[model samples]
Target: MELRQLHYFVKVAKKEHVTQAAEELHVAQSAVSRQIHQLEEELGVKLFVQKGRNLQLTPVGQLFLKRVEVILADLERSVIEIHEFLDPEKGEIRLGFPHSLGISLIPQVVAAFRKQHPNVKFRFKQGMYPTLIRDMIKGDIDLAFISPFPDEHEFVCGEVLLTEELYAILPPGHRFSEEESIKLRELEDETFVLFSEGYSLRPIVWEACQEAGFTPKIGFEGEETDTIRGLVAAGMGVSLLPEMALHYTGPLQPAKVRVTEPQVTRTIGLIRRTNEKLPLVAKVFHAFLLRYFQERIQESQ
Candidate 1:
């Protein structure tokens, strides 16, 4: 029968009196008696027997009561879990970012957010901008920190978190290392160390070189920004990297010089799937990130 019918049966069986069960349920005695009768008729079993002025549960009634109790308990627990899933203060955020950005930015933001919302936890996925965008479109990740700001219509970008100037990383004692600023065209003849395919920064650097009237002569390729910097330090070749790349703590710190001819820069923005409503937790974290970046920008100025 209906769940309400099962509920009435359990209450009446517990109190052993329809009138008292009705009082506890805040309903009329006849209402309770009528529902109990319908339950018995539906189940085709006599659930109660008249014992003096009080009612006594039959053997069948006792068995049914146990099953009904378990059902009601499970339903209550399910409702609680559903509410917790929607609770903003106590939910998980699925965050994505490029390996280059994650080196310093993600750790600082996550730590600051956790201090105020300790109950909130995060599932982090690291990938290049292309991979992160694909995952966002598939609904696999809630939000991402993307560079060169995605142009696809499937994603919405927030305010630029930061814009970093591109720098020329040169080996120690190289001819260009003596200059405060170098033109992109000046490195046309020199070999270049660049990021592997699928990284967003690679295209930005390549385009800048092309705009400067020469395609870079790629001599080596690497994945991590730190590794590329190390390669340049070992005199492998020169590379154009974001200003943030300089924060990498390593013994082999390549000399960094500003790129001036075209003045190349990359903008990073927060992104999410277009037209999809974020979960309460993700929405809260998104707002937090905007504020976090704004504060950092102000402090830097």
Candidate 2:
């Protein structure tokens, strides 16, 4: 009939004596008996047989006891999970990262986070800023590592994690490949291999070229970084990529030269849905990214 009734029933079933069950439960014997009786009436089953003050569980009572034990165990586990999720030291956190950041910054932060909170698990998805924002709005992602200046007011964004400088990946024999750094104007006549429109770098690279007083002459477009690199390595065309792409150890081999004209940089940040209650894990990750990026900024200085 109620939680108390179920507790009394379980206690009596365990001890097989109303007096002992009541004492163990810190309740009076008559109260336990009355509650058990009420539970029996509610369930339309006689849960106990009495013989000279000795209580014995009936067949139905034994079957029901198993189910009740399972339910109580689940309730206890649910409470524990809720508390650990709030504590940040345990439970699961789902976060998103842009493709480049996922390869560079995120792994370092995740390693540090895991060292401190081994019980916590992370589910990471790779996406561009727009897709990341969409997932955050749908509550499919808790937070995201986003590129420079997320413009939408519908989400909260933290300080920059790192600044990604654009670079031109030149084939082995290009004239400026040996230069320290090349200006965007140097690529005005060069064919450009670029990623698809959804990639965060696409807009930045395009804008950087426009700032140099010319539009990009796109020769090839692909989704995967590896594919784009392959195209460049085969001498299909030169491409503008984030500094992080130089770290790629894939088959593509291209000379990386920094972009000096207008000196473009994309500041990355942690983004979350505005006005939503963030879980403790997400909050911890957000703080971690800010600290990590600040240290990087200091080191570069």
Candidate 3:
């Protein structure tokens, strides 16, 4: 079957109406119908069947569609890869990061990078710890800034950029708010709010509490840092947040106290596919990232 037939078939499968598919394809209805018919005949299988007013894929048709989607996606990626190779600086970088980093770090980092490579573009995706790793392995993202990193992965390689400590977030006027640092166990009796299970920070907080000889009584779970911070600010509960999340200023702010007893910390890292080389633009950004964080680390020292 021709590429056009596969395209038409996928469009029809998605729309479930040949007329709509034709409109989207910007082709005549007859042409779309003819190609779908030709594709089925060539494969010796009925790819689609008529429903009440819509179309549906047959069992074999569903199987074929999966393979066709992969083929088409790979073809599209190849075209983009060629274009990127021709003009790396103007190409796009598909980057992924955890939800916690999105609030401030990602925007600041992108803004700083753009100053040096103004022509380059970026497509951002927010994922949890596992999702970010899986995305890089599947070739969906060129690079990612992952946390609790320096994590040993056979399919990806990376370096630790920042090893920032976690702080106990307390509501205003709490007894511990006046302290610069508090032990993990000191908050064990307090109601705790923390990032939900998927986040890398969650486990760090949990284990630190565990080591402190207590199981934290989680009163609320949040998917974002700001949500947890707001909950803490409202006296919903106390939370342990990374150093980066505490630097920003906002109205719903909670007091940040360092966790010194157990010293909760997470590593922020830059990771990429071990077997696949990054696009030219991504490579340049990767280098810049190393230097940027390096400078920050040095300045902090």
Candidate 4:
């Protein structure tokens, strides 16, 4: 049977009335009936039987209906994917990022790429590091921006785009705030404002504090980088934060001092499924991101 025949069968099965199905399919009722008749003849089965004014699928017809729907749906997806492959600038990208990059890095990259391919679209998913990686593996997101970039696993791979030094965020009038750069050990006595445990930044800060010979005394725990910064700026405590997270916090930003001794840093990078054959728009953004940071790093150097 032809593809149209299968399409007509599914429509007729759902609608249960030949006239209504024909009208919805924009075809004459006689044509729909003829196609349905031909499909039944080819398979040597009475696929539908009339009951009063409506049609109902026979036992085998009900089974065929389920498989035919799947086939048609898969065909439609293939058609759309090829269309995107032919003109990728008009395609869409499903992307993932952590909260840290949302305000600073993500917008800058997407805005720059869209200026060149205005028809390209983006759908973003924001979560913690492991969650984003799981999204890539499950194909929920074609790519992700992860910091302290992960090592490649059997299913996922990452590429470091840029490495930025982690800085200590101290209260504005705190003694260390006036110093140009200070050692991590110097803040051993201070209460620390930090991201909660699940956040990637939380472990980074903890590890640095551990290496510095002190376990940070907790003052307040928060999820958003802005919340952590705001608390510290209000003289609640101190914390370590990545450079990107520092850029977009507004006037309430705490005083930032570079960490000198036992200097720490985070690598902001992209992650994708190891086997993913990314859609054209996603590949375009991926390349743009890598080049964007490379150029920025070179300029700074």
Best-matching candidate per lDDT: 3
**Which 10-residue window of candidate 4 scores lowest in summed lDDT?**
72-81
**C-alpha lDDT values of all predictions:** 0.85, 0.79, 0.88, 0.87
User: Best to worst by TM-score, what's the order?
Assistant: 3, 4, 1, 2
Query: Which candidate leads the pack in TM-score?
Result: 3
lDDT of 2 by residue, 1-301 (tens): 6878878888999999999999999989899989998999989999999867798989999999978876764564455458765775876677888777766667878898788778888888888767888777656667788886576565564555666777788887788888988888988999999889888778888888899999989999988666777788889999877777567776658888778877878777777777766666667767766776778789999
State TM-scores per candidate.
0.70, 0.69, 0.84, 0.73
Q: Give the true-structure RMSD of model 2.
A: 15.3
Off-target runs (Cα >4 Å) in candidate 3 are 4-41, 45-70
Colliding pairs, model 2: none
Please give, for residues 1-301, the per-residue lDDT of candidate 4 as tens digits: 7999999999999999999999999999999999999999999999999899999999999999878876875675465468687998778788899999997788988899889999987889999988997777656677899887887578888688888789999988789888889999999999999899889888888888899888999989999988998899889999988887788546776999999778988888888878657776788788888888889989999
Cα RMSDs, all models:
17.1, 15.3, 3.5, 9.4
Model 2 residue runs over 4 Å out of place are 1-87
Q: How well is each residue in 1-301 modelled by candidate 1, as lDDT tens digits? A: 8888888888888888889999999999999899989988989999999998788989998888767776775675355346557775787788999888877878889999999899887889999877887777656677889887865564665557888889999998999898999888999999999999989889999999999999999999999988899999999999998877779667777888989889899999889878867767788889999899888889999
Q: Which stretches of candidate 1 lie over 4 Å from their true place?
A: 1-87, 155-157
Q: Please give the clash total of every predicted structure, in order.
A: 0, 0, 0, 0
- lDDT of the structure predicted as candidate 2: 0.79
